[model samples]
Target chain A: MKQDQDEFYVGYQPKAPAGIAGAVRGTVVLLLLLGAVAAFLIVREQKDIAAALFEFGVVREFEGVIAAKPYPMLRVARPDAAGDAEAFSRYLLVAPFKFGADPIVAPFDGKKVSLKGTLIYRDNKTMIELAAEDALREIGGGVGDKPVSFGEVTLKGEIVDSKCFLGVMNPGELKTHKACAVRCISGGIPPVLVVRDGEGTVKTFLLVDRNQGQVNQAVLPMVAEPVAVTGELVRLDDWWMLKADPESYKLL
Target chain B: MSLAYQAVGWNRQKKVYDGWLAVGILLYLAVFMVLGAVLFPSITAETLLIRGFGTASFVLLHVILYIGPAARLFPRLLPLLYNRRHMGVSMFVLGLAHGVLALIQYHVGGDQFPLVSLLTSNGDYASVVNFPFQLLGFLALGILFLMAATSHDFWLANLTAPVWKALHMLVYVAYALLVAHVALGYLQNHAAPVTTALLGLGVLGLFGLHAAAALREGATDKEAEADNGWVYVARVDEILENRARMICAAGERIAVFKYEGKVSAVSNVCQHQNGPLGEGKIVDGCITCPWHGYQYRPKDGASPPPFTEKIPTFRAKVTEGKIYVDPKPLPPGTEVEPALIQGEGVA
Candidate 1:
């Protein structure tokens, strides 16, 4: 059926036009202009902005206990907004840190520690400060009583109030039950263990979110074990969260 | 006789060439629009135009490549298959678009100097994998541009047909390079399976169709027959007016046709695929193949429009109530005056 249609017309070779070269040259010039504009727009969209962090500037050798459960949050604030108000306060519903201990006999609420981290100001009321894992160096203890500002320090502490919370457990059930038993122990919540740095002189954290299911799988078996975590120390309004990679801790 | 030859020279009044040029242009524009939507959205208008034009050129080459087979397979497709030189020129322009835009994107953007970057960026010249595929595309495009620039009849007449044909064959080389350019450079980075699959399917499909035609022709070659001055056969009545018939002649099938009150004899097979012209019909004063729609002027057996294939024609004459064919064939691309065959049995 298709071949029958091909028989109708005599094929002729068209003569090439004289001015075709000039027309093509003109078109190419136009095309170059189009490409340049498109490339510029794409590059612009991917650019990053820079801001200042003055108030939470440069704290030397600071340490503290895990005073509160550090829920990851994002705070966007204008530097010159009136009355130290935060422009954007959105909780990072999914915590990015993984935990490594069980709940039954691990550290409870008031763990102590001495650690170093950068203090980033996310506005006056809300500021998240943490010593990133890469910056965790073993600086020697302070000399004399001259109020040493060594810019960096390592935290020494005992495991305190640590229990795995809503993030680690299954979606609906936060209650102490057998269903949550996989993350928790026989009689306690999943370990959100907090270590006290030498008799509660400084407090720090050990909290894990649900997405770190692999770490939870590894840590749930070892309940009541004393461990030391090395990570970036972050401080946020009277609280500090250790942004530690799961590999940075050793169970003693 | 010279006046007659001049009168029979190419009929310029026919708008077949103009129609083909328009179709090619429209197809080029359509391809540009499609590539623009796919590759240039959210980009600056300048980049869009450059990339669009580049893609358009690639499509023009593709169109030129396919037109021959398309005309062979569908005679109605003949009108759309004219204007080879314009099509070539259009393809060259499009090639320029692709080459220049790519150069700006990968070379001249910032701190990198263009020439140094193309030559020395990825070690030595042997590693085409590491070598800038864009540069290869650039070179191929340059060749195409040069060819298009010289596609005039003046140049064609000056240069022998063989040299002209050899230069035109660079299109295939350019196409190969462009394919590599897309596969290695764009597909490697984008990693989109669908786009890769689509491109792969198109190239494979085109090649496969041509291959199928070639294979079919080869299979039928053994049964063809021939004789002196003409191939005397029982199926002479099968030749339709303005149409052709294939007669088996000494292990070769010869195309026999009648047009303008004249009988002409040429090889039965299409140059592209050895398609049986006997099964095809008369279309716009040409004998068209039924299998692929390749058309030939019955007077001279010259391929028309997009077809570049030429077959040896056997000088034919009707003598003493018998159709006789010459055992010797005129060289390919030969133009001969046709002789009329008489009798109601000669369909």
Candidate 2:
């Protein structure tokens, strides 16, 4: 057939028709430009990566009493403590990846212990990642304080894995991180019900059963989802504890 | 045409096509990665890589799907359709990387097996918006892998053209799954309205292009009127020399070619990949398929010696200054004598 005015492109030909080459070049340029624009849109739309920090590779030594009830944590006494003042600053503790520090700190519960671990923090919350080899060294037995009970209340918020929300992962409490949160919670990481109190400031409450026991296994399906809980809110020094059964948490 | 497969027969056009493809992929990836790192400082390396490769592959898929309809709408864009398998394979590789990285980050080192965790972590399948988007992506990746694995001509030949074509058409299913993945998975959260709008526009645009191409093809595909056994093609001069005028008569698709004072007819469907031969040009004395440059003799509908491809030919004649072709097709590789166009000289 006679060649039309429009250049016919043959894949095996040594040279493309000039008109076809020009068209393809123009299309390629436009595609690249569109790609950059798409990238910009997607990157800009990303949830502002939280200002949380994870000391990924830095380990520091700390001394504190291991609080192994409800969740594993380190209760370091405040340096400027006086009579009738808040006594200890609590830091939630977890092992590497998706596990809570229960197995590591169970033996030293209520005992003053020292360990080398990394710190993860966001807002006012802190969590320590313990080293596997001799993670805890019990220095002495320490007195543990009972949680000061506040009245029962209802709160609405999302359930998030504490390790990731505090800092292991950025922007960690949403559908994007849902599976990770579920995996973490299922693997025994402490789950926190992230909620907003009357003052409108968002706070996280360490979630536990009605008897104040670990609820990691029971709260698996509810992680990273909007939920409402009616529970007794208590304060253990700086730590906020929510006493509620996992089966009672309502999906919202 | 190749006598035996040798991985790929490197042609200058293919090299140029692949070289530009690589450049486009790298440029997009670089922009996404470098810019994402700069903009989202707290994003992890694994997340960055996963999003980078995922977005790049997603973009490549759009372009790849765009080319088929674009080539039909504007023939000059056929060059893009030629090396499309390369694009498919590259997109699959990128998707695989994204899936593997995500699995390691979210599933590995957890309490359960990674794959089981991925499948069982979220039980909200009953909800449309909250359906596990990763599951959609996983299924799409599986489809893409199938298409990519069988992209070679060897597989095409072994599976036969009709089956291979049907198999590759699963790309639409894969594309739909990916769109759902982005919509219900990524956009289910705090996505900007503009991002959602753009996604909607992209889906609409893909459908629009396909509709437009189908509309353009409607005219040629319409059934033609026949007198006795032969059907009217086009006026002798209307079919430019060395070009074929496609005519759909009854159920058969015919291409009537006029060249050098002679007229010949052959099936419009090329033996290779069912490419539209009527849209092709006579190159080096053979009808060269625009899609892959597969050539067949105009008279006998057979590939030149050393290539075994053949297509059905049809009896044709130029009578009263108009070309007509028999609605019935001759056997594949059947040689039909060209009917002389009385007034035309050698073109």
Candidate 3:
């Protein structure tokens, strides 16, 4: 085919490289199977029980006093509680009624109310979603706001989403989960401070603003890593709430 | 060779190119995933995949971009330029996987659509700290999809060479978008100075190589002098042994070689991907293409036996220690005796 022809070449053409048909075929099949397995596992793994909780159709009754800070929450006092320092008066109840008027406010504040809802509890964080507007019924007794004391403390921990850290994502707090954690926090998920005391007992605190509003954008950088937070700690309704400025957290 | 298509045209070179490409991708993924798992034990699988594929694609894009200018400076690097489009497509796949996984992980399960959420979630565009970086990534991915879908000879044929070349050049835009994406997206959260510094260094290196090559070519273009029907390329002593000096004349680039006490000239453009043959050396008595090792005889511009590739040859003479080559090119593979140096001893 050797010819002394004067053909004007116009452009560059790619040459076909060596073949790997069998290897390529095998790789495609393997990747397909792997993708299937990965999807199944990712979908199957329980990140949150929000959908399952709604699916249960279970009606729960809670007769408790409501605390109207951060959000309107119920403090269901445990009756057979001993005088132990670790045992708090009541556990705070979270309600999933965002972007609307709170069921318990002003007139219903500090009042004994019996609420009916589907209860979702994971780790130490508990939230309830009402099925109907009339689910929260005011029972007649009224009590004044409990006197709260805020003590300054320094704690080491990672800031994480209350939902995912409680049950949704297993081992969710790390450097690798930084971006996702930031997203979750930015998407209005309440940030929780997960810490270990000197005894190595893991404790969680709902991080709030100075006036106890839900902490969002400010705490994004502190999520998913070990950091030392200096803040005012208030033990209210069986939960420790941390109120601190974003600048107070030091990365460790 | 028609405009009608086959999914892939498998040849010895293409098969090898694709095989190595597949193997490279697999190895990269395996290493990335394994290292991620070991280094970050507390991270979820979703996070690992996002970081893994994201870094892999970013690194691969840089490698793909470097091949062009690197080949220009050194001919031996031409092999990397061959079938580089495959590398490009592979990068897009990895990038797509990363983008999709990240979207699902961070944006899905919300009230809004995932893609919509990605675009709208971070609305603090005015704030540098909270800039909408996901938009950059999405735009980049869009450009990549366009390039990948049209990276075929069929498109080239229909679109015409100049149009196709110009359209494919959007890769630079995609590259710029990806740089901004990483700078704003990943680095914003994970502030590792080493990683950031490395990325900066890579960008600088790319610009540095291109600028250096362009400056060299600019000097060559300015130095070339033409007379009547021939152009002064270089002095006989200017071209190193077995090497060639390239010159542009009469709307064609030519490579004038000095070998074995004789001088010869041929088209500078390689038959395989138009690699600069002047950058290559005469290996085993043939002008070996630096890009993919395609060889041709210096005297006839023809490939050796069992190969039929050819390129145009030109008349070159060394008169008074200065080499001058005719602007007119001879028919490809036409044997022409090399012009001998006057009074010079044979090597």
Q: What digit string (tens of lDDT, one per residue) describes model 1 on residues A124-152?
A: 22222333332223233321111112222
lDDT of 2 by residue, B1-347 (tens): 66687787888877887888888888888888888888878876777888889888888898899899999998878888988998899899999999999889888989889999899896488988779988999999999999999998989899999999999999999999999998887788775787788788888889999999999989999999889877888888798778889989979888888787898889999876999999988888999898988999998999998889999999887778988888888899999988889953221
Best by DockQ: 2
| Candidate 2 CA-lDDT value | 0.86
Error of 3 at B297 (Å): 13
| Candidate 2 segments exceeding 4 Å error | A1-6, A80-87, A196-201, B343-347
The complex in candidate 2 yields a DockQ of: 0.72
The residue-by-residue lDDT of candidate 1 on B1-347, one tens digit each, is 01111212344523444454555455445544544445434333434455456555655566577666654454334444434566677677666765666455434422335565454332225665434465567668777876886676445445755676678778778788888866655454333465565567658866976776566555545454444334564344545566665556566677667665567777776654344576566666776765435667765677775655577777767554445566466787787666555542222
- The A-chain TM-scores of all the candidates are 0.28, 0.90, 0.62
Expressed as tens digits, the lDDT of each residue in A1-252 for candidate 2 is 334474678776678888788888999889888988887777777764776788888999999989898788899989998988777889998999888778888889999999889999988789998986778888998988899899898989989999988888877788978999999998888899988668857798999888999888888778778899999999999888899988888999
Question: Least accurate stretch of 10 residues (summed lDDT) in model 3 chain B?
Answer: B35-44
TM-score of each: 0.48, 0.95, 0.61
> Distance (Å) between predicted and true CA of B340, model 2?
1.3
* Between candidates 1 and 3, the TM-score winner: 3
Docking tier of model 3: it is incorrect
User: Model 2: what TM-score?
Assistant: 0.95
